[model samples]
Each structure stands twice: as structure tokens, then as C-alpha cells.
Target: MVVANDEGGVKPSHGGPAVADAAPQVDHGMLALTLGALGVVYGDIGTSPIYAFREALVASSGGNVAEREDILGVLSLIIWALTIIVTIKYILFVLRADNKGEGGTLSLMALARGAFAHRPRWILLLGMLGASLFYGDAVITPAISVLSAVEGLNVVTPTFEPYVVPLTLVILAAVFAVQRFGTASVASVFGPVTALWFLSIGASGVVHIVDDPEILLAINPVYIVYFLANSPEVAFVTIGAIFLAVTGAEALYADLGHFGRRPIVLAWLAIVFPCLLLNYVGQGAFVLSHGGIVGHPFFEMNEGWALLPMVALATAATVIASQAVISGAFSLTRQAVQLNLLPRLEILHTSETQSGQIYMPRVNMLLGIVVFMLVIGFQESTNLAAAYGISVTGNMLMTTLLLAVVMLKIWKWPLVAVVALTSMFAVIDIGFFVSNIVKVLDGGWASLAIAFTMALIISTWMRGSRYLFEKTRKNEMPLGFLTEQLAKKKPQLVPGTAVFLTGDPLSAPTALLHSLKHYKVLHEQNVILSVVTAQQPKVPDQERARIEKLNDLFMRVTVTFGYMEQPNIPRALAICRKQGWKFDIMTTSFFLSRRSLKASPTSGMPLWQDKLFIALAKSASDATEYFQIPTGRVVEIGTQVAI
Candidate 1:
């Protein structure tokens, strides 16, 4: 989809010119991006097999009857579930929804908002809210993925079983602790490890398949029908379990900008999807053969030495999955800041070359604390799993609704085709949504809490923007009118360069206004440098920076990079120096205004919430130094405004 920046002059850079077109070269190998995307993208979906089949068996009562029919039925349902849900729907279809080669709720939202910016107000609000819920999903992902992985030990050792909560806590603590170092340090191992992990799952399934060859019949549609026909209630609850397998399917799209959509789709279709199915089949086979072991049959599948390796492998896989979610949270935060929904926090790029692999310390630390508390509160992965599916399902529901709009309103597809296609996906999503509702009282509230928090943030940003628009004088000082005034007043003032750094380029720059009001001078060479952070994993140096001349004298140059990237303004200034640009850093001072927000009764929002949001903004946002501005020649301007 074509995505336009809110700032009118800047063009969308899907496969076009990017802002950082002049930066130094850094080559993060295709393998590194692939593995990093794999590590981050596959977390929740990777660990789904741990509970998906087991929960389904428990719901079906097929666990107590280990007959050939039961095995066939369970295997069929699982195989078809993987095929229809993960493979066909998400990997094959929905991954195509890209906003200038970027995918995710935010990218999709940006695309939608930009397209319908001039349309009705409801469309904008709904799209923004949907994107905001993704933040909540990011928080809940790691907590549940690691928790479920640690729970596997219960089947191996009874003593170890009770320590699942503490162990998950420790694992999460370690996961969050390592974020400051960035994934570049461990990028080499993720690919081979996750590849081996999938192989092991396939191997485990092969062993079970050898015992009962007839279990292969479970791949047929008959078993799914039989299970559903027998007990609709059981099938309904199993929807929650089945949805787990496809929980992180959207990550295939969300992380598409990092690895590109092709590689991710290839990885999911080839290595990830097949192995997940094999494991589910294996689990189903074990359940069929030993029906009465419903309570914990996953661990009961093997005996002696085999049990230990399986347990160890599952733990490692779980940790890997959790690591992915943590990294995703960092990416989401960067996206939020770029879209202006959240404050700019310090973002550190671990690798100089690979822009996609980033490390944000604040997000890491906050997620660490939350995941640790979650592990202790839930005490077991299964319990945590109850909270896991809700956020993803909610996101999918939003996607389903929005895709309908995209097809009908945006794409202008035939109404019949749109309804037919969207209705099918909606039904599948609603099944998962209803199933997750059963978990609402069983630790499912955590994701909801996080979603509400993010919703508040997004809502506040929108409200604040509206307030600023309403209160500001429209004709008080126009840039075009002021430029005409400057041209007539001082014809000789147009010789040197004046660079103004701004938060939003389309909006009137406070720095520019201050200069016009105080100095009464305008440079012949004016540079409006806008720095935009991309949400993807890495944007190439060629894609990071850009320069455009606005009628010779007024130039608007923007520097765009990933959040995981470093800001080198001095080095950039040096590049400008090579171009014969003249500016004395000491004499040509930098300007930063401190916005003092006051809560007025005028804004149609809850006063308490507005005050809380303002406080949160003040406390949570990083200082100006975080954006890498020079301190010596900088001038601070504080302005008060009522909200």
C-alpha cells in the first residue's frame, strides 16, 4: 500500500529515496537479518505447540480414550489447523498487507490513516486504536512464551515442576538483562538453534508416527468434523488452544520490514510451519496411544534419557522465543515514538551496519520487571497461556475488520468478494476470540491492562494534537507570508545557512517562530532538518538520510534511521561541510523549547486522565540530549500551553 508521511514534502520511501542516503556503509549479512527476524518473529508462535495440542486434547476428552480414532481425530485437527490458519491465511494472504514495504499494526495504521486522513473521523480513531493494542500484545508475549516453555519440566521431574514460576522469573530476568548488549552479540546462534529446535520437534513426531502409522489419517477433514460434531462446547474451548499456534502469525507481517516479507514467508512456510505441525501431530499421537494421561501427557510421551533432552530443548526454545518478544517490544516502542504517539526514549543500535537489530534500554528494563512479576503471579506456563491468546486474537479481530475496509473502501474490490473473504477470516478469528474469553478470569486480565495503558497513551496524543490545533491562532504567523516578508525586508540576510531541527516538519516550527520574532533575520540558506525514526529492523545508510532543496535557499533535509541506530549529527554536519555548507556551530545557535502543558477544562477528556497522561509524558520521556543535539550553542525556550 502507498503510505504518505503526514509531513507533506517528504515522499514515501518504499523502494524510493530515503533520508539517510549519504551515510557510511554497514553490511549486516542476509543471514544475520534472517536469524534476528526469526528469533524475534517466531517467539509466541514457536512455543504454541507446547500447549496447543495438549489443551485441545483436554478439551476434547480424547485424552482418556487412546484409540486409533482418537489419535486420528486429534492429528487431523492439528494438521488442518496449521494448514488453514497459519500457512494459508496469515503466511499466504495477510502478509501482503504492507505500507511501503513495512508491515505491522502501526504500518497498516499509518497507511490507513494517511489514505483516509481527509475522510470521516471514526476511521482514523479506529485505526489508531487498533495499532495501539499491539503495544499491549508486545508486553504480554514474552511473559507467556517463557512461562510456557519452563512448564515443560513438570513432566520430567515433579520437584522441578513446582519451581516453574521461579525458573520462568529467572529466565525472564536474564532475557531482559541482556537487551542492553543488543542481539548482534547472539545473532549468530539463533538461526542454527531455532533450526535445530524445529528439527527436534519433527524428530519427536517421527518417533510417534512410527508407532501408529494410521495416525496419519488425522490430516483429513473428517477428524476435525468428528471432534466438532461430537461436542461443540469442547470444540469451542479448543479454539483458544488452536489460536495459540497462530498467535505470532502477524509477526510474520510486523517483522517483514526487518527481513523483508519474502524471507519471513519462506522461513514460516518451510522450516517453522512444518515443524510446528509435526510436534502437534506427535503430541496428538501420544494422546491417542495413552488416552488417560490427560493431566500431563506432553512429558509422558517419552521415558528415561529421551525425556531430559526434550525438556532441555523445550526450555531453550522457550527462552529463544521469549527473547524474540522482548526484542519486538523494543521495536514497537521505536515505532510509537516515530508516529508521535509516545515520547522519544533513548534507542541504541547494537550493530553499526545492521539497522534492524536495535537495543532500547528503557523498554528492556520495564519489560523485564513486568515479565518477572507475571512469572511469579501465574506460577505456571499453562496459567500464563490463558493470558497469551487474548491480545493476538484482539489484534487479528481488528485486522479482520480493517482488511474489510481496505478491500471495500480503499482497494474498491467487489463487495461480494470482500464479504466472502473477510467473513471466512472473521469466523476463524471470532472462534479464537470467544475461546480466549474463557481465560478472562484466569490471568487474562494482564494483557487487557497493558492494552488499556497503551490506549490511554494513544488517546492522549490525539487529544493533545487536537487541543494544540484548536487553541493556536491559524493566521497569526504563516510561514509563506513570513517568507515573503523576509524577502522584502532584508535582501542581504540570505547568504549563510540556518539549520532548524524540528520534531514535526508539517507543523509550524516553534524554533523558526522564535527566530523570526527575536532576531528579525532570515538566512538565504535555510535548512529545516527533520529526523524521523523508522520502525523496521534496519534502514540502509543509503536509506537513512536525504536532502532536498526547496527553491534553492529554503531546503528541507530529513535524516531517518531505525531506533536501534545511532545518531551522528556531527558526522552528518561534516558531510554538509564537504558540500561547501557554511555554518558556525557557536554563532548559529540550536534552539529547543520546553513545552509547559496545563490541564484546562476545555479538553473533552477526563481531567484526571489528562493530568496522569501529562505526568507520565514528563516522567517517561527522555531529555533533549537523547536526540543527540549539541549542548554548547543550544538555546532553551520554555512555553506554557493549556490542554
Candidate 2:
């Protein structure tokens, strides 16, 4: 049975400690967390007003008169989409399926996958596709968000038109460059600036919304239903754009662990939802008064004097949102590495106190390259819209499918409740997915291409890892046999503890056996250490380490860390002291086996895939640094593997 970390973590099904879900008392701590969630979690949806409405209206009118019905219908669709997709489906439903209080596509997958010891491997395929889609979204978010924000300069004068793309490229380069400093340093300012952004947009919308109060009629569901009934073709095309309003809905769940469910939910209900509603309404009002301001309805809503200031705030807000997605990608990569779906990557912990704040140089550099290319290539937010819609919608659909498994199999909800809820979600999600599918020829193919490439890499890595595990195990001797032979050999007893790091706890580590063969010496105490990544996001300190005596001189030590956590073998070993095992930091030596992977024609995988696997392993970060082991006390043994 699984148990979750207690207090700030989730409780496992095996009656482990649970993070409290009780409402916090009125305090600055609670308010600060809520405000922080506002800045990070809602930035994408918050900035959607800059482009979503204009794009949808353009699709609806098709350059004809922007009739009142068309404006109201699009507005009505945007309103209800946000309500059901973001508010009900995500915040209320998917967030509850979190793994140890961590919610994301991979976390949800781990939680569901952990519930069954045996199941079809195809289930993992869905999770991989979701993660791949997230990468596509990551590349698009910064490009579209910054491009749309900078496009506001066009309203001030025609002079800024030619320079928009160049300016956006400069801003993106600087933003990616600062990722190494970590979010903790900048998050304090992000919250307040975002708060101001919401206030300004709400007030801006209020100005137009009050003048044309008739636009408020769009909030009624009748307009949406009637519009679709009367003009099915128009409604179908328009909704492909309307889906933009809730594009960042998954962020609410993906970022749940950062601020907790209470803070994220509070931020949405109290701040984000209201402002987004107002801005959308204001856009509708502007469209009604001025027909077909399709290319620039959002900017046109602002008064002339306020245009420049609003543009500046918008650029800052979009930068903040883009940073949020990049950081999420780093976290996702680390989790994938720990789960063995991907090869190990170099992970740098940026914040001393916050484990969640990290920087991945490889991921950062790759994202920077892709984002810059997109900004220059796409050149306009309208063109990038098709690609953005496909990525986000695909991710949303994947979440729904994964949540169906969680609801029926993991959470054990009633069959009727499960069927009804998933069916409703499926209809809406499938509609959005289908609408975006038509745009594949119009740059929507970009997201699909990224997803397919990543899925292939991930699957190949998993398969390669399994093959190596089996190949190595075929030569490994059991611990009992090793101990028996060692007693008979009577090798020289060394002075201190020797810890052998092994991938498999059941078999003898290659390093330990190699040491005996080469030097014919054994330590006074031999500790077989295996660092296991748990399926949960975090394993509590109390349950982190387990110790068992294999014999008088040999002991089996397994240290468990959550996929979200950084592994430190030294720190984990210290926990064994309470269990009657004395661990000394000064004299202990860590033995690590480094494999030299060779691509073979007869390898289980195709020759090209074998080469790809070798390249990934060669670039993988060193195990000693990854496990936080001291360099001075580490020994490396090399092995050749043809897989």
C-alpha cells in the first residue's frame, strides 16, 4: 500500500501521514501564498485577453459585419468554456486526483499506475503523450504571449510595427538567460505586478462594459445555444479560437503542489476568474459598438492615453507567465528522469530552502532555441494561434482520459458518477480537439511533430533501460553466494564502511564484485545501497529509509525518494543510525558503476535507436553529482554494455 508524506504532503492509501486540507486561519502566511499563486498559476489565462477575443471574433465574422448575435455568441462560448473547463473540470475534479498533493500529467499517471501492480503498458502511452504535448505548449507559450504583448505597441503608432518581432526576440533571450537565478528571487515582485494587471484590466473592461451594458446579455447561455443552432458552421470555427480563453487551465492542477489546493483555488475564485470575465465582456462591448475590429479589439478597448502603460504591464505579465511554463518543464524533466522514462539530466537546485526551485541547463537552452525560432518564423500571434490551440487542447484531452482511470479505478467513485462526469468532460474536450485538428496544415502540425518526437525518445529510453537491466542481471551473483564466497576467500578486511550503489537491490552490485576481483580486499562493513524513486511525489522523512541485515557483515539498505525530490545518499544514510546502524560521514566510501554503452547491430532495438540510446547515456549527468555524494569519497568502476 502507498502512503503519502504528512503535514505538507499527501497521505498514501496505506494510512501514511497526510498533508492537512483544513482551511487556514486568517493570517499573512495564507494571504501571501494566495497572492503568490495569483502571479504564477494564472498568468497564462490572465494574459489570454490580449489575443483570444480578437481571434475568435475574426473567425466568427469572416470579414463581414460583426453582428450583435455573433459577438454575443462568441462571448457566451468563452464564458461557459472557462466556467466548465477551468473552474469545474480542473479546479474541482482533476486536482483531487493528485499524487501526494502533486498534480500534473505525470503525477496523475504515477498515481494511477501505482494502484495496479499489473496492467497493460499502453496506459503509460497516454501519460507520455500528455507530457510530450506539454513540451509543445512550452515552446509556444512564450512566443505567442510575448508576441501578443508587444503587438500592443502597434496601437500607439505605426512606427513600432516593423520592430515587434525583433523586440520580442530580445525580450525572450533575456528571459531565458535569467532562468538560472531561479523563481524564488523574482516571485515576490510577480505577485504584486500581477495583482495590478488584474485591477487595470478589470477597470478597463468596466469602462466599456458599463457604457454598453447590453453586452452583458452574452452571459446568458441562450446566446451560445441559439448561435450554434442558427449558424453551426460559424460556431464550429469560432470555438476553435474561443478555446484560447481556457488554454492555461491545466496550470491550475500542474502547479497545485507549489502553493497547495487552497491557495490556488482561492486565487482563481477571488481574483483571476472575475478579471478574465470582465475583460472578455469588455471585448464583446467594443465589438458591438465598432464592427469588425477583429485584428485589435483588445487594444482598441483602451483609451489613447492609457495604451502605452497597459502595453508595458502586459509585456511584464506575459514574461512572468512564460517563465512559469519553462520552470514547469524543468520539473517535469527531472521527474521523468527519476522514473527512468528518460535518461538522467543535470539538475541544478537554485533555491537553498525550496526544493521545487530548479534550473535545467539542457532543457533551458533547448527551449530558448525553439522559442526564438517560433517568434521569428510565425511572426504574428494570429498565425501562432493554431499551433497553440492544438498543443493545449491535446494536453487537456489527455488529462481527461487519465482522470477517467483515476476516478473509476484509483478513487473508486460510483460507476454512474464516473461515467456521467467523464462523458461530459469527453464531449467538450473532444469537440475542442476536433476543432483544432482541422488546423494541422496551418501550423497546428508543429505541436503534433514535437509530441511525436518526444514520445519516441521517451519510449526508446524506457525500452533500452529495461534491456540493460536484464542483460546485467544475467551475470549478477546473489548476495548470499557472494557473502559465502567472500568468507571462504578471506580477503583483507578494510578499515572503513564501503557503500556500493546498485540499480537492483536483489542482485550484487557490479562495483562490489569488481573490487573483489581487482584488489581482493573487502571493507569491515559492506553496505549495499539502492536509491529507489517512489511513485509518489514525496516520501516522508519517517518512511524514507529501510534497513535489513543480510548477514553479520552484509546489510541491505534501500533509500526511497519521491520523483519530485533530489536524491542525497549521504543524508539518507544518516537516517540509518536510529535503526542501530552506525554511519560515519568521514570514512565512508561510495562505489558507483559507470557503464560504457555500445551500439550493436544485434541489439534488441533497431541500430539507429541503439545509437540514440548510447548518445543519451554519454550525455547523462554523473551519478555521483546527481546523488549529492562527496567527490573525494567516490570510486568509479567502468562496465561495457552492448545495448
Candidate 3:
């Protein structure tokens, strides 16, 4: 996993560190993490019963409630979709593609890119695209989940209809507002509450299943084939809506790192899957018996007194779902920033003990605004449903493709086996993807638009960075050259140490060169420091830093960090003392280089992209603060670069 940086002595860990130690904090017993999974991983899909069935029914049959075949067909589609897509693809396969036991679009992409040894351009594009789609999914999941849950109020009383949108907005607003305060306290109970919610809905559906024990025939694939054959028009539209049943399925894989693979799989198979099947079949039975009950089939399944309680519990479950997605967005933003896909913003760690618990104010604020506007724009859960699933499907499609590369190239699987396994998943994914695409004009485009905009920005930043690196490398002076020049000139030797940050350790950092040139002095001790973020989730403490002494006065130190860990220069510097390198907080002065970027048509990128990159760089998180170096002891040297 360790790849040496010849220039700055930076060593990148491609394979990541030992995972046994990577997840210690989260390595709770299976039962505990399962409870955690039930609370977080399954929240999105768990809340789907709130509107998925009713929406599909309305989309398929409309007022033709007497059509038993349509109901059974929709049921079959839902069942198979959950089995094929959620169970087989994500839970069984994609979950296995963890990056040092972490899963997500970016994580998968990093794994795939690393497997190639050399970064292939297409993998980066796919990763960026998938990551972008997730942001869109993040915004939509909260809006739709909350709106659908609050819409339950309309069933309690027709008088509550007008207030549904406003209530949803207020609830969602409250959800986003509390993010800054952290969810450590509230997150614990989410599992028990969600588990209860699943059981309640399952029981409600089971009670109604007695109305039509014949609905059990839906477990037969023949019914699905027969229904699709008899009613093609209804089946097509129904398939699109049926996708809603597994809307939050991606959360299982996206959150694999939090609860690990086994607990999430256990939670789904033991609790989530069965509950979903019972409730879905129960909804089907209820629809057939009541001739499609009015005002949300899910809420209608509950008898008189149960309606209010059901609504309240449903609201709570949806809130949990929204919370998970919002937190996911925050996590995704941090990943993007660290990977240099996005500009670095302020990152606030919310939990004292859990390294994963982080909050980004800019991401939260932006997500809140978009989700609020989406709620107001869509107006109803049913309407918002049209916008859901596109991004999820897109992300899945990309993940499937990336998984193929991992299986064939990374895992050394036979090409035939890789193609066969990936193709099976691809067929289902492409179906769902196309189904969601039909909804583009109906609101799906909203997510696509957001994704496209993000892809534009991510690609721009990445491309601009590649050009910047190439340009910087082209003009670099060799490390030996700088050292020899210092020795020959015999510059005034200062008392304290100077740590200069550079991306390439072999070259002289512009800041170091500038400092030496201007002051005609060199520190008693000098460090060519390069900070690296590995492709893996968590790098062990033992492998955090690598120090190489090139000569008596100079040392090249490459500090390695896993993507999941934070970067702190002072703390990392302290690690070197154990190995005979004296690191004094008071005596060390950090030097940073700031590039004054100028856009040129003939430079690294188009003028517009160059300008955007410059703006992002200018607004990035402060080097002193980001590195956790003392502000008073840090110095920044500027160098102009044409890009």
C-alpha cells in the first residue's frame, strides 16, 4: 500500500492500512452494530412503505381499483426489485467491494483507481459522476421522506391537508438546524424507534393480509410475468413507481463502514427485509379487500385509533431517514474535499470520541436550502416521488460498472465470471435506471441537473489540479540541487526548525526556496514535509508517518493519513520524536506556499476553469488551521503560477 514519493518523500498508501485497527471504535458486537444499522442504514428503505405502494397503485391503475391483476403485478415487481436490486446487488455483491472495510461511491472509485496502479481517466470520471449523483440523492431523500411522512396528517383529518407542506418544511428545517449540535445523543434511540416502526407497519400489513390470503400468490414469479403480459402500459408505469419500494437501498452499502457488512446484512435480512415483505404484501392484500383504500394505503391500513399513532411513528421514522441522508451528505462533502474533488470548507468534529462524526456548516446550509425549496416545489410526497430514484439508480449503475473492474482486474476473477455476475446486476440496474429516466420531465431532471452541475465542478477542479501539478513539476528544482546550494552558500543557520509543506518531496518547496532566498538563512533543522491522504478508510497509527534522513541537516518526512482520519501536523510531528527526531511545538515554524493563479488561454485549462480553480484555492480552508499548526508560528509564501 505504501508508494514512495521521490520528490518530497511522500509515501501514499494505496491498499490502506490494517483494517482490524481501522474500525475499533465502531467494532461493537454484532448485536450492537445491528441495532445501529437498523437505526441508520435501513431508515430510508424502512420508511418507503409510507408512500411507495400507494404511489405505485395510483400510477398503475388509477381509479380502476377492481383490477386485482394490477395490484398483484405491482406487488411482484416490488418484491423482485427488492430481492434483485437491494439484496443481490448491494447487500450481496457491492458490499463486498469495500475500501479497507468502507463503502461509498468515492470509496469504491478509490479502490478501483488504486487497483490500476496508475489512475485511469475513466475511473475518475465514473467516480466523480457517482459522487455527484449522491449529492443529488442526498437532497431528494430528505425532502421526499419527510413530505411523505407528514402527509399522513391529511389522513387523520382533511383539515390537515393545507398544512402538510408547511409542516414538512418546519420538521425538515428543525432537522437541519439541529445538525450543528450533533446527533450523538439522539442517534442511540433511532434504532429502537425504527425497529418498532418496522414491526408496527409489518403487523398492520399482516392484519390486512387476512383480507386476501390469495395475495400470497405474488411470491410466484408467474404472477409478475402474467401481470406484465396482460397489462403492459400499467406495468411499465408501475415498475417506475415500484422502484420507490427500494429507494433507500443504497444506504446499506453507503454506510457499510459505520456498522460493517455483517451487522447491516443481518439487520436487513432479519428485520428490514421481512418487515418490508410483510408490509408490502399486506398493503397489496389491503388494497384488494378495500378496493384501494383512499388517502395513502399505508396510513389507511391502520384502523381508527391507530391512525394517529401510526402517523406519529411514521413521522419519526422519516425524520430518522432524513437525518441519515443529511449526515451522509456531510460525510460525502468531507470525502470530496479531502480527495480534492471539491473546495475545502470548515469541518467541525461533532463527537469527541467518534472520528466519523463530523459536520460541515456550508454543506448543511446548502443541503437545507435545496431540500426546503424541493419540498416547497414538489408540494407533496407523491409529486416528490417522481424526483426520487434517478440519482440512486445512476449511482448504482456506476457502482456496478466499477464493481466489474474490481472483480475482473483487482480480484483477478476470470473475465467470464466477472461479466456474468456484473451483467446480471447490470440488467436490473439498467431497467431501474431507464424506468427512472422516464420520470425526468416529471421532476427527475432536478436531481440530474444538480448532479451535472456538480460533475462540472468536480471535473473542473480535478482537471485544473492535474494541469497545475504538471506545470509545477515542469519548473521544479531537484532536492539535491537545493541542498547543495544551501551548503555552498553557507546561509545563516537559524536556531529553530523549519517545516515546509510540499506535494513533491524531491523538489524544493517554493516557500522554502523563497524563504532561503529572501532571508539568506536556513534553519538548524529542516523538514521536507508532505501530507498524504490514502485511498483507504483508516490508516493505522503505526503507519501514520515515514521519516527519511537525506543528510545531516535535512530530513524528508511523509505523513500518511487514511481518508477517515483527520490531519494534524503538530500531532503528526510529535510522532517523529519517538524515532529520535526532536519535534518541539515552540521551536517549530511551519512554512506554506500559496500560488497566485492567473488564468491564461494557453495554460493548463480553459480560462474559465482556471479561474474557478483559483477561486476555490483562494477560499480553501486555511493551511494553519487545517494542519492544526500554531497560527502564530505559521508563515505563508506566495508564488505566481499561470494556469
Candidate 4:
């Protein structure tokens, strides 16, 4: 889970206490939070008007001049997509399914897993798939958003056309480049700037809306029925483009932990929803007045003076949208690492006070490269658009499936109610997914490929980790056996304390056994330490450590951290001090085993996958750095392992 810190940093999830359902006492803090929601939570959906309406109209009309009915039909679809998908499904229902005040794909998966008596394999698979698809969305969002925004230059003048892709690449590069500096300062302005964006778009929308008041009638659901019935095939194709309107709807739920449900709901209803509705409707109005000509209606609707400013504002808004998505990927990556779905990567906390403000250089570099390739390959926003909706739709479908389990098992909702709610969402999700599926040859394959590759990596890492743990356990002595023998044949005793970090506490760590074999001595104070990741987002201090005394010669210490937290061994060991364990860093030496893994054909996974897992293992971050242990007080033992 990615948590947003109280400093208003743009992390994936919020680490602050969950906001109450009751209206917060109106204050500058609450106001600031609401504004922040506008920027980070709603940024992606807020900017959809730039291409959603135009693309739907173009797809419906088959690239020729659009008919009046086609314009109204596409407008009605876009409006209702937002209403049903974003408003009712996400804002009303999905936001309510948060996990302990936290919300995101993995958070929901963790919640759903706890609902069962035993952890189900399918639930884990679903979570992995959802997270993988999110990475796909992460890459595509920046590419499509920036490209579409820069394409607005063509509306300024055809002379600016050649520079659109190059300029977009520069802007995107800058966005990714600055991620190393962190988003704390940049996040401060995200809300205000995004709020201005909403106001500007809303104002432009109202101007054209007044010119053709008849466009208001598109709000009726009857138009959608008529439009679909009249041209079923066109409607099918248009639904994929119409899905662009709600592509970021998942963010509403994903960011539920960040800004809270009330702020997100309020931001959407008061600002984002209204602004998007007006702009989409106004684009329809503008198209109707021009005899159903729909060439860049979002840009054309703004006449001479307003067009340039709108383009500039639109570009800024898209960059913000891209930023939010990239940050989300970082957060999700951390969650995967904690959950043991992926290999450990270097995680750098950007803020001292805010644990949520993190930067993964490897993740940032990978995203930037993929996004650049997308821009170079697609060359136009319309082409990139063809690749966008599939990942988002697939992710939404996975969410719905997981949510049904939550509703039935966790919330204890009636079977009928859970089925009814999920079926409605599943139908909508399936429609959008199937529509996008038809465009597989038209660039949709890119998102699928990315998702598939990520899923494979996650699955391989998980399987490999499990295999290595079990195989290593088979070769280790039980802690009870080791301590009993030590008590009978006491070796030369060292004066200071020694901590052996291992995944399993029941067995003696490899480091401990190697120490006895090489030096023929044991420390006076020996601790068998295991770091455990809890299912919850943040474990309380009271429950952070569990101490078990095995005998005078051995003790077991377990430190628990929430998946959202960074493991600081010293800080956690300090908690042990309260439990009568004298954990002085100066006198304590940490022991760790460094594995040299080699692939064997007899291992469970395929040969290629075994190699991949070994490669991933090699790339994993150093244990001392990851666990925040002091380097000077750590000793490493090497071992050979086959998997």
C-alpha cells in the first residue's frame, strides 16, 4: 500500500489516520486536502475531456463528418460512462470497500485474503494481475496524456504540428527527471493548479453550452439507448473510446486512503464531475453548431484568444496526471516488494518526516524509457489512445472481482446484494474490455504485453522465493536442537550480543551455524530475529515486536511491519527494549547469510524462469541497506543454494 503522509506529499496511499465519514470541521487544512484531491486524485479523469469526446465522435462517424445523432449519441455515452462508472460504481460503492482506511489494488487484495479462513491462491493471483495491469496503465497514462495535450498545438497553428511529439517528449522527460527530487514541493502546487484547470475548462464549457442549450438533453439515458439501437456496431466501437472518460475512475478508489472518501467524493461532485460534464457537453454543443464537424472540438470550442491558454493549461494538467500515475507505480512496487511478489529494489525516502514520499530510481528509469518508446512509436495521440483503455478496463474488472469477495466475506453482505452489485459492474467492465480487445492489432497489444511481462515477473519472484525458503529450511538445524546441544557442550563464549536475521525462527540461521563451525564460539547474548510483514498497512507500536525466550543460550525476536512501512531494524529493535531486551547498537553485531543461487533442472520452475529468478535475486538491493542496519556492526555468511 502506498500511503500519503500528513505533509501533503503525493504518495500512493495515505499514511495519516483515516478521515471520518462525518464532515470534517471546515478549516484551512480540510480545504487544502480537498484541493489536493483535485490535483492528485482527480488529475487523470479531469483532463479526459481533451480527447475523450473528440475521439468518440470520430470513431462513431468513422473519420468523416459526424451526423447530429452521432454527436449526441457519443456525448450521451461519455456522460453516462462517467455517471455510472465513476460516480455510482467508484465514488459510491468501491470507495466504501477500503482496507482499514487504506485503498488500492494490493490493499484490497490483502483485505480480501484476510476474509478467507486460509489464504487462497486465486486471491493472490488476482492481486498480482491487478498490480501488473496498473503498471501498464502507469506507462500508457503519461504517453497518451502528454501526447494528446501537446497535439493541441495543431489547433494553435498547423505550423506547430511538427514540433508536437518532440515538445511532448521534452515535457515528459522533465516530469520523470524531476521525480528524483521528490514531489513534496511540487505536490503543494498540484491542488491549486489542478483546481484552476477545472475552473478554466468549466468556464470555457459554459460559454459554448449557452450557445446550444439543446445539448443538455444528452444527459438523458434514453439517448444512449437510441444511439446504440440505431447503430450497434458503431456504438460498440465508440464504447471503447467513451471509456476514455472514466479511465482514471480507479484512482478515485485507489487514492481513497490518501485524501479520504469524503474529500474525494466532494472534490468530484463539486468540481471535477461538474467541470468534466460541462466540457464534454459543451464539445457536443460546439460540434452541433458547426454542422456536426468534430475536428478537435475540445480545442476548437475555445476560440482565438482562449485556445493558446487552454492548450498550455491542458499540457500542465496532463503532466500532473502523468505524475500521479508514476507515483502510484512507485507505491505499488513497494507494496509488491513487502508482500514478496517482487524482488527488493532500492527505495529512497525523499522526506524525513513522510515515509510515503519515496523514489525508486529503477522504477522511474523503466517508466521513462517505456513512455518515450510509446511516444516515438505511436507518433500521435489518437494512436496512443487505441492502446490506453484496455489496461484500465482490465484493471477495473479485476477490482470488481476482488471486491465481490470483500463484500460477501469481509463486509458480510448478503449473497444477493453482493452478486447484484458486482454483476452490474462486471457487465460494464466486460463491455469496455471487450471493445478494447478488438483493437489488439491497433496498438492495444502494447498494454497487454507490458501487463503480461510484469505478471510473469511477479509470479516468478513469488515462486522462487517460496522454493528457496523451503529448500533452505530443509538443510537447517532446528533452534531447539541447536540450543540443547549448545547447553550440553558450551563453547567459548563471546562477551557481546549477536543478532542472526533469518526468515524462519524455528530453525537455526545459516549464519549462526557457520559462526559456530568456523570460530567454535557463541555470543553470550544471542537473538534469533525475524522480520515479518503484516497484512495491514501500518502495525501499531504495541504489536510491533514479539519476544520469545527459547533458553538461556537462545532467544527468538520477531519484528512486524505493515506492508506500507519501510523496515528499519534498529528502530524496530528499539521497540524490543521496552520488552526487557537490551538492544544496544554499539554492542550488538548483526548476522546475515548471503545466498549464491544456481538453477537446477530438477527445480520446480522451467529452466528459463529459474535463470530469470536468479537474475532477479542478483539485482535485489543489499540486505543491510534495505533493513536499515548499520554497516559497521553487520557480518555476512555465504552459502550456495540450488533452485
Clashing pairs in 4: 2-13, 3-13, 3-14, 4-13, 4-14
Clash-forming residue pairs, model 2: 3-12, 4-12
Question: Judged by lDDT against the true structure, how good is candidate 2?
Answer: 0.85
Q: Write the residue-wise lDDT of candidate 3 on 259-329 in tens digits.
A: 88999999999989999999999989988888655347888878599999999998999999999988888
Q: Who wins the lDDT comparison?
A: 4
**Candidate 4 lDDT (Cα, whole model)?**
0.87
Q: List the global CA lDDT of all models.
A: 0.66, 0.85, 0.83, 0.87
Candidate 2 segments whose C-alpha is farther than 4 A from its true place: 1-25
TM-score for every candidate vs. truth?
A: 0.84, 0.94, 0.94, 0.96
Could you tell me the lDDT of residue 485 within candidate 1?
A: 59
Candidate 4 contains a number of clashing pairs equal to 5
Question: Candidate 2 residues 505-623, lDDT tens each?
Answer: 67788899899889888998998877777888998888889998877678988788898998888998898898998999889988888778888776689999998878777777787
User: Candidate 1, residue 174: CA error in Å?
Assistant: 0.7
What local lDDT score does residue 619 receive in model 1, on the 0 to 100 scale? 54
Error of 3 at 451 (Å): 0.7
Cα lDDT tens digits, model 1, 167-260, are 7777777877887887878866777777777777777777776655556677788887887777688677766766766777777777777777
Give the distance in Å from residue 542's predicted Cα in candidate 2 to where it truly belongs. Answer: 2.1
Give the poorly placed runs of model 3, Cα more than 4 Å off: 1-28, 62-66, 293-295
Off by over 4 Å in 4: 1-25
Error of 1 at 38 (Å): 4.5
